[model samples]
Target: KMSFGTGHHATTFQMLRHQGQLDHQGKRVLDVGSGTGILAIMAHLLGASKVEAFDIDDWCVENGNENFDLNGLTTRMGLGTIRDVQPQGEFDIVLANINKNILLDEMALYADLVKKDGFLLLSGFYTQDIEDLTDHAKPLGLTLIAQQSKDNWAALILQKKA
Candidate 1:
């Protein structure tokens, strides 16, 4: 409905592929740019306690809600912006599969949303963008813990430092 992520793109695929490495059990999860709600649904299935997701696209919001219904799982889906999300009190795992510019602009917000040592999974950028992203993220309390790439797309697993 929105843009990207029907689980067919390289960024989405790599995120799902590397998902198992992190512990999602009983964690609160947040999905930004939550396309078809794939990652949100997956997080819930992985045992995330509360899964919340939002997208700026009305179609994505509608489609995400439908997907949640289809999966028999309930996720808080709506239209939102990064600024609307008060991540500080809201999540333990934050997933953002957006383009390079948005990723850079909101990395600090994502880092703030996660609790100490909580995980933030990011993708939707080419491999060359990692250095700039990481450089911006380091001082904001996010540390690169893992990364995976395929066909020029890169996915990163970062943890908020305690």
Candidate 2:
């Protein structure tokens, strides 16, 4: 596959497992750096009213759209960073399974896109890097609500403070 996130990597697996536990019914979700659209598809399957995704890689964007098609979902998939995505108002949940550097750089943008009291799920970093991620998120008013780890990889669920 040209894209990433086939639910095989530890980070992707934890992201999927943690995402399944959330209540997605009737919610608007955003998936950042969506590779193969796995997380975006999961949101739809979980009952999210709308699912949108974006990736920096062109191949990933194409693969994501194909995956959405296969899943019978009409998700809006874009090719670029979060900044390039068209505004669709605040989301009920924002999932970013990107690396630590990108997450840290875009933390504020992600926070701004989530509705107050909504969720922000993140992964794609080592368990030891959780502190750096959390520390950066805290000031953005995103409180760490839950976390999962496997094989030194970690995923975090945070809530935007109202």
Candidate 3:
């Protein structure tokens, strides 16, 4: 299979595990820092109606494109950070498995792109980072719903309040 994620990293594995619990059918998804486009590609395979992805690195964008073809999926791929992208619309699900600083800095943008009650899944931080991250996100109308951690790395599922 086309490998955007080798399922090795703790953050990616936790993110994927949580993603399995959500209903992706007909949902719209945003995979920020899409890396190899693994999350985006998985979103498509899980039946998301719209899967959009972007990364700041040229290599990631290139490799992501190749991975899409390998999976026989067509994803809207681009090169940019989440901060630089314009709002398309609120999404049903947003995935950000990037590091703590970026997650903290871009939390508001991520929250804004989520529809009311939509899910925002985040990772690529340590367990110690949760409080700081959630604290920042809460005031922006996000409620920490669930969290998982593996090997000092952590993931969280937040929902936009209605």
Question: What TM-score fits each model?
Answer: 0.94, 0.96, 0.94
lDDT at 8 for candidate 3?
A: 83
Model 3 TM-score on a 0 to 1 scale: 0.94
Q: Residue 109 CA error for candidate 1 (Å)?
A: 0.8
Better of 2 and 3 by TM-score: 2
| lDDT over C-alpha atoms for residue 27 of model 3 | 97
Which of candidates 1 and 2 is the stronger one according to TM-score?
A: 2
- Each model's lDDT: 0.86, 0.92, 0.88
Find the 10 residues in a row with the least total lDDT in model 1: 82-91
lDDT of 2 at 80: 88
Tens digits of lDDT, candidate 3, 1-162? 333455688999999998998999999999998888888888998999998899888888888888878887776578998767764988999999989999988888998999998999999999999999999988999999999999999999999995
Candidate 2 Cα misplacement greater than 4 A, ranges:
none
Q: Supply the global lDDT for candidate 3.
A: 0.88
Summarize candidate 1's per-residue lDDT along 42-112 as a digit string, tens digits. Answer: 88889888888889888888888988898777656878787875544857789999899999998878887
Positional deviation of 3 in candidate 2, in angstroms?
2.1
lDDT top scorer? 2
Collision pairs in model 3: none
Instruction: Report backbone clashes per prediction.
Output: 1, 0, 0
